[model samples]
Target: MKGRWLVVPTVAAYATRTLRVPLAGWSLTGEAQGVGPVTRRVYWIDIASPRRPETEVVTHLLQHLPEMIPPVLAAFRRVRRGGGPTGVGDRFTVLMLGVRRGRVQVVEVDPTHFRLQTLRQHSESGWIEFRSEPLVGNSYRLTVVSQVRASSWYDRATYLLGVGILQRMTWESGLRRALKVSGGRKAGHGTTTVEWP
Candidate 1:
C-alpha cells in the first residue's frame, strides 16, 4: 500500500513531462497497451428533442462529472498540473472511496468526443470515451464506451470482488445525467453491454 501511494507522484511527473500533445495527434485509446482480459462496457441512450443538442450534452458530461457520479464510488478532480478549458493533456486524479485511486490524462476532446487515458500507476489501464451523436429518427444518443483492463493482478482481484458493480452504476447514472441535461426523455430502456473484444 505504501509503495503504491509513493509511486503516484513519480508516475504523475512522467505524465506531465510526456502528455503534452494536441488532441488531433494523440490517439491513445490505450486498448493495445492494456493488461488482462480486455472488456468494453458501453452505456448509451437515445433522446428525443434534446434541448442541449449533441455537443452540449458531451460538454455538460465532462464539466459536471461529480454530479453525475456518486463520490463513494468515484470522483474526478483536476490536478494542479492541469488547468484552463478541458482539453488534451488535462490531468485528473480519480478518487475512489476517498483514496487516490488512479490518474488519467485527457488524451482527446472535441465538441462531440472526449477520451481519457489511464496513467502508469492507475489500477486499471485503458481509455474511456464519451461521445454524443445523432441517431435515426432525428434523435441524439449519448454513449460512454470504456475499453479497459486491469493493470495489475491486485486490481483484477478487487474488480471481481464488486468494483464492477460500482463501475456499472457510474456509467448508468452518467447516461441518465446526459438525458436530463439534454432535457429529453429516454426513447427506450437503455443498454449496458459488457463484452470481451
Candidate 2:
C-alpha cells in the first residue's frame, strides 16, 4: 500500500446528517438515503501508502478481502451441486448485528481498479470498489468506495443506526492494521460524505 486518503460525507433530502469520526489515522463518513422502497448509502475511505503499484495493492486487497473486512461479514466460495467451487459467485453471510446472506454478482480485476458486488433479497445489495491513483513523489493513493442498498424501512433504519457504524469502525481498524502490517503508513485523515436520493 502507498498515498493520501480522504473521505467525504453527503446527506439525503429528507434529513441532512453529517458525522466525522477520526479512527487511527483515517476519517470515516457514513451516508444514508432513502427514496421509496430503495435506500442507498455509501461509505468511503482513502489512504496513501509507500509508493506501491496499483496492481499489487489491488491484488493484495482482493486476495485478502476476508481478512480486511469486518469479522461479522463471513465470506465463502459458492459450491456447485456437483461439488465444485465457483470462484466469482461467492457468498457472504453477514452476522454482525443480524444475519443476512448475499451472493457476489460481479468481480473486476484490473491494474488500477478492482470491484466486487454482493446482492441479497432481504438484507442489502452491496458494492465495494478500490481505485489507485498516482500522486506526487513515489507514492500512490488508494480509495475504497462502498455502496449499499436496503429494500425495507426496517433494514434501512437498522443499517443507518447500528450496522452502518459498526461497519465503518470495523473497516477503519481492519484497513489500518492491514496497511501497517503491509509496510504502509497513514498520511492523514480521510473524509466521508453522505447523500440521499
Listed per candidate, the RMSD to the true structure in angstroms reads 6.8, 13.3
lDDT of each: 0.74, 0.50
Q: In lDDT terms, how accurate is model 1? A: 0.74
Off by over 4 Å in 2: 1-51, 73-94
Per-residue lDDT over 97-154 for candidate 1, one digit per residue giving the tens place of the 0 to 100 score: 5543577888888999999898765667798899987888768878888888876666
TM-score, cand. 2 = 0.63
Across 1-197, the per-residue lDDT of candidate 2 in tens digits comes to: 11122111112211222111112222111223222243333333344556556567666766566666656544433323444322345443333433343345435666777666644332455566666666666555666676656635655776766677766676566556545544666655464745445
